[model samples]
Target: MLTPLVDPDGAPFWEYAAQGELRVQACAGPDCGELRFPPRPCCPHCRSFDSEWRRMSGRGRIWSYVVPHPPLLPAYAAQAPYNAVVVELLDAPRIRLVGNVVAAPDAPLNSVDPARLRIGAGVKVAFTLLDDITVPRWLLERT
Candidate 1:
């Protein structure tokens, strides 16, 4: 599996995942609490430099997905035919995260059958440690 480069702005997200918590960065401005992803130093909503990590429910629905074809990079070729999904968070509808829908937290990317995936299907967050970082994956709500 490929590891994500941890930048200062997104360090907190990885830290929370390591503790089994899914959180999103939000503006800490007194009157503005807009959430933002790709954690940045400033808020696009209120132009605030202050920010905080807000705990999320980790529930979402598949908003979109695509099953990749062959000719993938070596690092991902082994996981070919797997689906990459865009999940829309339940609590924060506007916030969508990109990941794979797997059968288990540590399961391989192709663990879930491609035929089983569908847009609008409910999913819950599952975490798996990749190297020193714990990353979040999604599992079907029913199975």
Candidate 2:
């Protein structure tokens, strides 16, 4: 599996995930309370350098997704039919995160059947440690 390159601004996010906490970066500006993804040093809304990591509910809906076919990265080729999804957070609708939906936190990439996936489906965050890094994945919510 390919691990994410942790940068300074996004390090805290991975740190929180390691502790089993889901969090998003938010502008800490007094007048601007907006959430931002792909964590940055400055808030795009208020143009303020002040920022904080806000805990999230870890629930979301599948905004968009794709099932990659073979002829991809060597590492992911075995999981060719796996799904890569963009999940819109329930609490912060505008903030969407990318992850794979799996049957369980530590399940294989293709653990969930592709036929069961649907747009707008409810999902919750799940974490698994890979090569010492805890990464977030998703699990379909029972209707």
Candidate 3:
């Protein structure tokens, strides 16, 4: 029961992730160089259509996090107290993405104990299949 964060746009980014690749949108225009996520057809900076997909290293630090403690939808009530984290990718410093981490695809959202989740912790990408989409999750990396 994997729900995808998808849209009419940004489909390609998910497609690549499904293949176990992390990619970002980059500007191909001269001078207005920049990279971004949540893909757009043109550069947000210079509005350039000359953009391409570039792979990322997929390592990041925890920017912020919250542990949800309540009446989660009835379906998820059993998995209450889960931590959702906003991770700032080292490859894309200014941008961040949110996800959960687990040892397996079917692992509960609350699988990563709060005691183990912290701001500034080093994390690496992990993938879990929610139906057909392979969503990116995260895991604390050992020193």
TM-score for each model? 0.96, 0.97, 0.89
lDDT top scorer: 2
Candidate 1: where are CA atoms >4 Å away?
none
Per-residue C-alpha lDDT of model 1 across residues 1-143, encoded as one tens digit per residue:
77889999999999999999999999999899999998999999889999999999999999999998872667888787798899999999989999999999999998999999999999999999988889999999976
- Residue-wise C-alpha lDDT for candidate 3, range 3-95, written one tens digit per residue: 876874588778888888877778889997698776777788988898878888999999998876673467667777777789999988987
lDDT of 1 at 97: 94
Give the per-residue Cα lDDT of candidate 3 at 142.
61
CA lDDT, every model vs. true structure: 0.93, 0.93, 0.79
How does residue 12 of candidate 2 score in lDDT?
A: 99
Task: Judge candidate 1 against the unseen true structure and give its global Cα lDDT, from 0 to 1.
Answer: 0.93
The regions of model 2 sitting more than 4 angstroms off are none
lDDT of 3 at 137: 87
Residue pairs whose backbone atoms clash in candidate 2: none
Give residue 78's error in model 3 in angstroms: 1.3
Give the least accurate 10-residue stretch of model 3, judged by summed lDDT.
Answer: 101-110
Model 2 error, position 88 (Å): 0.3
